[model samples]
Target chain A: MTAAVRRRAGLRELGLGLALPFVLVVIWEAAGRAGVVPQGILPAPSLVAAAWRDWAFADPGLGLNPYLGTWGETVLFSARRVFTGFVCAILIGVPMGIMIGWNRMVAGAVDPLIQSLRPIPITAWLPFAIAVFGIRDAGAVFLIALGAFFPIVVNATAGARDVPRNLIRAARMMGANERQLLLRVVLPAALPNIFTGMRLGLGIAWTAVIVAEIVAVKSGLGYVLWDAYYVGRMDVVIADMVSIGIAGFLSDRVLVAVQLRVLHWKQAVRA
Target chain B: MTDAVAIRGLRKVFEGRAGAVEALAAIDMTLAEGEFACILGPSGCGKSTLLNVIAGFEAPTEGSASVFGAPVSAPGPDRAVVFQEASLFPWLSVRDNVTFGPRMLGRPKDETDALARRFLDLVGLSGFEHHLPDQLSGGMKQRVGIARCLILNPRVYLMDEPFGALDAQTRMQMQELLTHVWDQARGTVLFITHDIDEAIFLADTVYVMTARPGRMRSRIAIELPRPRSIDLLTDPRFNALRADILRQIREEAIKAMAEEERARR
Candidate 1:
């Protein structure tokens, strides 16, 4: 294919992706302007966009509006919590998962405990988190980390366990010691599964952060959402919701980009 | 020097949920250094189990196997294996898979890379260094498996039906490639196959094994010309060897079928 044709195809894909959102926005704007949507129940996309702009760029001198110019700070706060909690989850969960999957003794000792605790919802742990860490950032981080850990650990265990027996035998025959077997063969073999778990865990991490911010913390998008709703500022609530969605989407994209790079060999085969 | 590999009264019995299944019994074999030997048998005749015992991937229930006078206990670099499925690490590129052994042993990067390049060329996969196993055809993947083992410069090459999954055309091409590679490398090879042609084409000695509770029934020496080629398959001498082996295996296969019927009853 010529470069021009390829470029045209690329543009067509972009247009196709944006078409639905553009249509939805137009319909939403028309409904709000026509008063077909109940007043103050659902804000128009335009109104939410305006509110979001003010929340992000309006000067604090305009005063008295807590959300004014606080979008960056709030996003940062939530993002920081998610990042910290997810990192902690990865550090503890990955090694623990590998151990549980690699060794029968380790599985026997820890797998039952994990399976038993997994059934309890992250929201159910909110009270316990609050009691332990006391409505601070620690409580929020704890909740996020705990929520994300289950999927990460579970997937990692499955990944490690499911490594082909022949790969292990091949590695051993190649003079790999037990440590080398785990690091070079088993770990790399388990990577695709580990990435799957991480993606799932990250999605849960975003949810946990929003939940924690709503109940136990006062500085993020979730807090803004609740506070704006209480004040009857539906526009601000809508903007906050959109902000959270964008943040979750962008973070997930970042992970997928990294996964694609790491699993490029897998991609090449599929391609 | 001691034999490259020796096995004495080797037996393997798998304890399954159904009952104890005897896979191999009273198997004795020996291979000289730089020899290529193939174990030919019917399906489920414990040929693969015997190869695994020699490769140290499986322990014999009775008696023992040794490589160069050392008792086989665990898999090592000295006994590199080429599994039937190729078993190349899917995540690694062809170059990486080929160099896995040398890299694992912490050989100098420059030396290992040179060695990898040499063997990749030897296997006719020189241009596919960056390809993943899944991207390659069955024959190419098997070639990579061969290169991966060859890079180790092993004392014994244990191949378990290395071309068993390929199409007939690909299998014949691979057999020719194997003969060329084996001609140059000259390592002791213990290849397991149910293919009579493959056994005769590749081995210096073909050990025909009996059906399960498998024992070494006969060993036939192939006096085929050196640096053999596919044309040898039509040679009168090659035809004679093929006929003799085929006759023995046909009887074993029939007996195995009868045994299966008995078990079913």
Candidate 2:
């Protein structure tokens, strides 16, 4: 199809996707105004949007609202944590996973330990993190890293293990030594899986950051969410939830774009 | 002078949970330097196992496989291979795939680049340097496979049914291309295939193999003229050789089918 035709199709798809949500929001607003729904307990979509606008654009000096002009800082604080933790997970997870998948000894020595630890939820580590890192950013970052690590490593291991046997033989026949085989053949073969792991790990990092911020850190969207709830600012709470969803969705899209570029050969095959 | 490839009393038994399955039993073969040899057999007759042993991809369970007097132990560039599936690295462009061997051996970049151009041109893939393996046709991918091995300039070429996956027309074209390229870059070759016509056309000496636990049944030398082309398919001598090999392979194919039927039961 032509680019223009494709773009129109994409726009149609977007329109189709927005239809249900738009209708629901309109119904929700009608219900709230008609007092069929309790406004205090479940604010209308308009209320949430209004609150979000003020959270994002209102001058703090003119308003008594603590959330005024705090949206950007709150998003940045959470984003930075997720970024740091996700990077840490990738740095440690990818090589370790590849080694585990490539070598029997490494798999035997490490895979069991990871498997056992993986079953313990990140939420369960909250107390331990608080004990070690003392309710600071370190605690939140630690949880985010720990939460993201499993998927990255597991996916990396799977990627490495799934490399075609013939490709390895072909490389060896081309005079690749053990190290060269791992770096050239095995690593490239495992990349698709590694990226899959990174995407999953990044999602978990976002989750981890929220969980960490809510309980262990003093600032971020997660902290604002809980604080808004305690003070009964339901509109701000809803706005915060939507903000998290958008951030998570945007981050995933970025990772997917990178995956397409790196695995361009794969894209050609699929196309 | 040492034989280009020498296999003596070679055997390969694959040990599975189902117990030991004999693949090649007490096989012996040799190819002189610059000779083009094909092992013709029925499907599942262990012809590929024989080639694998010589390629150093598999160890002989009983005897030895040697290349240029060195006992085969591990696969190396000196014994480059063109696999049945082409098996070009999917991520690499055509040019990179062709130059893989030389680059792996740490050859100079400019030298390998020029060599890549020549070999890719030899395989008629000069215009597809940037195309990824997945973007190429089966015949094109196999051309890259051939070019990669050619760039190695190896002591021997181990081809395991490299054109077996293509359509008959493509296969014939590839055969012609291979012969043309082999003429220019001559090396000892050990080709494995089930096609009677392909064997008759390509081989200097055709070794017909028996059914499972394969053993050599006959060795018929092809006395066809060089610069062989598609026209040779209709030649009386080619048909005679094909007829003789076809009879042997049919018997083995029947036996193999019977064996599979019995196993299923």
* lDDT for each residue of candidate 2 in A1-271, tens digit (9 for 90 to 100): 9999999999999999999999998999999889898878899988999999989988888557788888999999999999988888889999999999999999999999999999999999999999999979989989999999999999999999999899999999999988988998989999999998899898889889998999999999899999999999999999999999999999999999999999988978634
lDDT of 2 by residue, B106-151 (tens): 8988899899999889889888898899988899999999999988
lDDT of each: 0.92, 0.91
Residue B187 of model 1 has an lDDT of: 89
What is the lDDT for B180 in model 1? 92
DockQ, per model, reads 0.76, 0.73
TM-score per candidate: 0.95, 0.96
State candidate 2's TM-score.
0.96
For model 1, residues A1-271, the per-residue Cα lDDT tens digits are 8999999999999999999999999999999999999759998988888988989999967568896898999999999999999999999999999999999999999999999999999999998999989979999999889988999999999999999999999999999999999999888888888999999999999999999999998889889889999999999998888889999999999999999999987778654
Candidate 1 per-residue lDDT, tens place, B18-122, comes to 999999988888899988999999999998899888888999999999999999999999999999998889888899999999898889878888888899999
**Candidate with the greatest DockQ versus the true structure:** 1
Off by over 4 Å in 1: A1-24, A36-38
Error of 1 at B198 (Å): 1.3
